[model samples]
Target: MTFALVRVRRGDLRLDLESFARYAGVHPDLVRRLVALGLLEPVRERGEWWFGADQLAELARIERLRRGCDLNYAAIGLVLDLLDRIAELEAELRTVRRSRPPTGGAPWTRTDSR
Candidate 1:
């Protein structure tokens, strides 16, 4: 997959709901449902609702999981949880490997000098 870099405001980024919906290739009403489910955070401006890039990214993830894994929202949540746990474990494994010493520096000897 390709990734793009975009700049946003210092404190937070905001996009109109229409823009966010288009980015996610979903209907505005469906986006509203996701927002209602507490999975997305809405930005308010004079009673208007906007969404952030982070929220868009999350929706994209959910969409991918739904289409690729054929999972419902509940199942998606569980899969995300397990994937997060796996990532954490992988990170820990990397840290442990980095902290260990190399084992092939010296030649092996068969002498018993105890």
Candidate 2:
């Protein structure tokens, strides 16, 4: 699997609920709703919720899907399920190919002299 490395600006490195809401261009209640829906996870530190660069990126993706597409949460869930199945099938195909014998014919044995 491939992972992306995000570089956060100085002030954007760590965010509380308010900062995360402002940075993600959404309302705090909406952010809370996303958290409730398992779309975003917040870090708990010293009695405060914190968000990182990855969380910001995930929020952006969710927002884009919400704005750019007509998919509701249930539809998004179905799409994610299909994508996961595709990944599993691809992995299985790779494993099956690796376990198969070579397509070339077997080497010929020496025949009796004439």
Candidate 3:
């Protein structure tokens, strides 16, 4: 239940649509279709699609969902949302467990031996 921190770089953090597609390990057509389906939104610069490095992870996630499941784009979004909630719940559970005291089965008792 560990989370990886994603760090964004100041400069050279942007990639064009093709580079983004390559970085995501998905097809360009799929990227276009995702944009058309509203599953992804990229910045349009001078008629070119540009994506930030932050989106690389998200795109990879989407690619995994698209390839791993038979779900449509909308369903994929729902699944991602559920997964995020599950992670949050798991973290909270860990915190609660840490705060609780350990319990033993029974207390020790001493009997008179005289």
The global C-alpha lDDT for each of the candidates, from Candidate 1 onward, is 0.75, 0.74, 0.74
Q: Candidate 1, which segments miss by more than 4 Å at Cα?
A: 1-8, 42-49, 105-114
User: What's the lDDT of the predicted structure labeled candidate 1?
Assistant: 0.75
Which residue pairs collide in model 1, if any? none
Q: Which sections of candidate 2 miss by over 4 Å?
A: 1-12, 77-114
Give a tens-digit lDDT track for model 1, residues 5-74.
2235687767677767776778889888877766677867678777777787888888899999898877
Per-candidate count of clashing residue pairs (backbone under 3 Å) = 0, 0, 0
lDDT of 3 by residue, 54-76 (tens): 57877778878978887778888
Best by lDDT: 1
What's the TM for model 1? 0.66
Root-mean-square deviation of candidate 3: 9.4
Return the lDDT, model 2, position 31.
86
Q: Give model 2's TM-score versus the native structure.
A: 0.58
